[model samples]
Target: MTAQIENTGPLTTEAGAPVADNQNSETAGSGGPVLVQDQLLLEKLAHFNRERIPERVVHARGAGAYGTFTVTADVTKYTRAKFLSEIGKETEVFLRFSTVAGNLGAADAVRDPRGFAVKFYTEEGNYDLVGNNTPVFFIKDAIKFPDFIHTQKRDPYTGSQEADNVWDFWSLSPESTHQVTWLFGDRGIPASYRHMDGFGSHTFQWNNEAGEVFWVKYHFKTDQGIKCLTQDEADVLAGKDPDSHQRDLRESIERGDYPSWTVGVQIMPAAEAANYRFNPFDLTKVWPHADYPVIEIGKLELNRNPQNIFAEVEQSIFSPHHFVPGIGPSPDKMLQGRLFAYGDAHRYRVGINADQLPVNRPHATEARSHGRDGFMYDGRHGGAKNYEPNSFGGPNETGRALWQPVPVAGTTGDIPAPSHAEDNDFVQAGNLYRLMTEEEKGRLIDNLAGFIAKVSRDDIVKRAIENFRQADEDYGRRLEAAVKALRG
Candidate 1:
């Protein structure tokens, strides 16, 4: 019987048993119904039914590529992260570009902030720098985040994105004015993912070997240069080629036209954060170049196209709190809130063992965790102690913290942030408006008016214009007139 064993060829069941036929299901009789005893058929059907996982809440639509980040300048004075410790050191990176407010099936050319998330596989561990294309956000605090996303998402009753909901929310939240102005400008609808810049929008803390802390912001200036599509051009493209951005990124990489970004950082001394004219940690604001100039640090190049989109891109996860030895979170309220929220979302959406997935697992080092037995948990570390502090040589903490301690004081209640001089939301937005060329300003006003005019209520439109009016007299006046003309 052993010598005459069958089912040893290329075509076999999942259990390595040979399959005589994969063309059709087994039947009780020659022409009778299919049998439940056909385990192969059952397995195939069951696996196909459960092939998909839950989509992300916010950045649902995205494209991703694998790449390399090579340090060009020594930043050891500012940080001790191993990947950036020495010049010419190269780190494997995975970058995912996404649309902010769209579902998995939504058009890619819509006017939305692109999610630029990078996962660095460093020797210490996996470090995730999750950010957006824009340097500023709509709200400074994370408590208001859900409400802001609700306005952008589909309305419950109407089942569509209502202009009334959008205008109403913006009118009430004055903090949204800066990001709103950015969203309506020419750069909002990028021509392709490769053309626009990426930013670590929130301030972060970088501690050097001597434990000197520096607050920092990150930038990725595309070597391809900035290119954007006008509203009319975007409208046609969104309708005609919904996957244009995704297709462009994949095709560019495949054709050997790799995309690259010149990485830079704006470093501010930790002590100077408090006395700055405006709140430095505010998520809705930015430090002017005149205050802290950007220092070029590295080069990021995306060269490889993902072979399996679902495995490499869709299953990948990132969180802002995934820092290395030198980098840590800042006092930005939004950043603090995200430290919990992003990890929680991934734990629920992906399994707790999502880290074990190939795309998310650390490359150079093993992820030693006591956590065991969750959905999809690969039975690694067999027979090893599940708990730390075992006498049998289990992995233990290194006694050093991954990041330096930040000092804190005062009451811990819901007290608002400390008020700073010139901290109002309108100043930077107004400055941005004034900096635009005459033609660019006209396009921005037109874009704002085109959307605002769709509001059902006159009061909503009036309130919307009032926010921009506070930013700049000319901006508000021009936008109000443009909205009026569009409505008529």
Candidate 2:
């Protein structure tokens, strides 16, 4: 426990000086302007002015909670991460659920991908599983990420989200087919955060104790089961109760109806990835269950809420690079970009001392670093040696990396990923569409048409339809007919 300072008196200034009166500011005379030397008054005003920070560029609207992850199976054979070493092992966790394309004050029920990021404060360190509710993403390459997000955001000229901007981008980036299909489907708007599934979405790596490696994907099946809101329902709920999802999540935990998920993973041998018919590391696709079934590993449950939302939840940060021994990054382009992008965003958004915060700090172990002060740095290292390989007994590295060396062969150049036989982007999206029921298919077409019909140019609408048609003839035909019906 941290040392607590005993309070013996009443109101005091931030510097611990006793305050004479909080109600009125010091003045030269009655009706005279207040003196500029009132330190308490200055402190209050200064602090109030600095209350807000820059909100996240994406996933701005969010809700989070404290939870426990209990290993229900032995995953040591697959990975050396201590948290998953044995059955019944428990680790503390914090999970943040969010909407992708919205501001901090946006409605919680909007039709957008939900961020399903989790921070596991394990014994080795904090391992963050930063993911989303959907299994696939819009684009495969990080180079297109900013452009893709720009389309989803407000238009530069119109000052509002335009169907023209959105369709123009999606139509040009054919790789977005799979995710667009998933987005405008029946599960587009989740009924509540608890009633949906979560996925790592990107391929990751798992190295066993014997030096054997595997490609891995994660799935968190909600124990609460799948439930969703229709387009009509979401439209009404977004206006009537913008905080509907956040409120439900908070109240559910408070009333003892704690939400939980069954954690699982699909593992593929490293050797198989090269010949897997499709790029397993592609962020816009998925490994079929017929090839690699999901193996149940553990249970994740949220049982506690933060006392201070700003201190704990708002300041909480995550990055895919936060991994323990045996778990490491994959060659997924999006994941590679995220490893750097996430930490940099947090450094600027929170502070260089963001990790020092109680919410983001490792729970089971103290993080020792030779780093010195920056903005609001606590100076925890004291007068210790800053440089490595020093004569002084500084906190030196173990001379071993937490992650294994990744083999590199081909000369790096500006080229697309090495293609596999079934590498076309439309396949998985077509498969997803075919898997839907008749009613679900009708709704999907209607959803697509509703927005597609709003586009001003016929070329943009045709290009968008052509991408879906490449995925499936019937899907494209139905969508085209729906758009015509809506437009005419």
Q: Estimate each model's TM-score.
A: 0.96, 0.97
* Candidate 2 backbone collisions, by pair: none
lDDT score, residue 33, model 1?
A: 94
The numbered model that scores best in lDDT is 1
Clashing pairs in 1: 7-18
Cα deviation of 129, candidate 1, in Å: 0.2
- lDDT of every model, 2 decimals: 0.93, 0.92
Error of 1 at 434 (Å): 0.5
Residue runs of model 2 more than 4 Å from their true location after superposition: 1-9
lDDT of 1 by residue, 366-398 (tens): 998889998988899788889978888889889
